[model samples]
Target: MAKYELNTKEQHFATTRLEAEAIVTEAKEDKHLIMHKIAEKHNKYGEYFLVDLTFSYNTPKEIMGVE
Candidate 1:
């Protein structure tokens, strides 16, 4: 099983890639939101996130058996 998520000041979890992407698109378009640094992290469980270190926004797309 895998999961996806979008994070800003808050963490938003999604069940599919499409949903996650939608969240990202929305966040990018939100003028009230500040997006500075973003990073991708791969964990042992194959879960990864596009993260902003300060507020720590994590967009995670998990694929089974993938690093």
Candidate 2:
């Protein structure tokens, strides 16, 4: 199985690519996160690779300083 890493406002990991994709999609819809970057690194055989996704959550400064 392949390992998936999602680096959003927080970091998350998945055991499969589909799960990682789903997590990003859900975050996009529910949290309004933007996709910043995606990368995959393969092993020697190229049979498995680690997927990394970076998501950015853009919140206004006004919304962050106060509760």
Maximum-TM-score candidate: 2
lDDT of 1 by residue, 1-67 (tens): 5454444364565544565566677666655455533444556766444533223334343333245
Q: What is the C-alpha RMSD of each candidate to the true structure, in Å?
A: 16.7, 9.7
Model 2, residue 40: what's the lDDT?
50
The residue ranges of model 1 lying beyond 4 angstroms of the native Cα positions read: 1-8, 36-67
- Candidate 1's TM-score: 0.37
- For model 2, residues 2-67, the per-residue Cα lDDT tens digits are 333333555565556776677666666655355433345456655332334446444455345654
Among residues 3 or more apart in sequence or in different chains, the pairs in candidate 2 whose N, CA or C atoms overlap within 3 Å are none
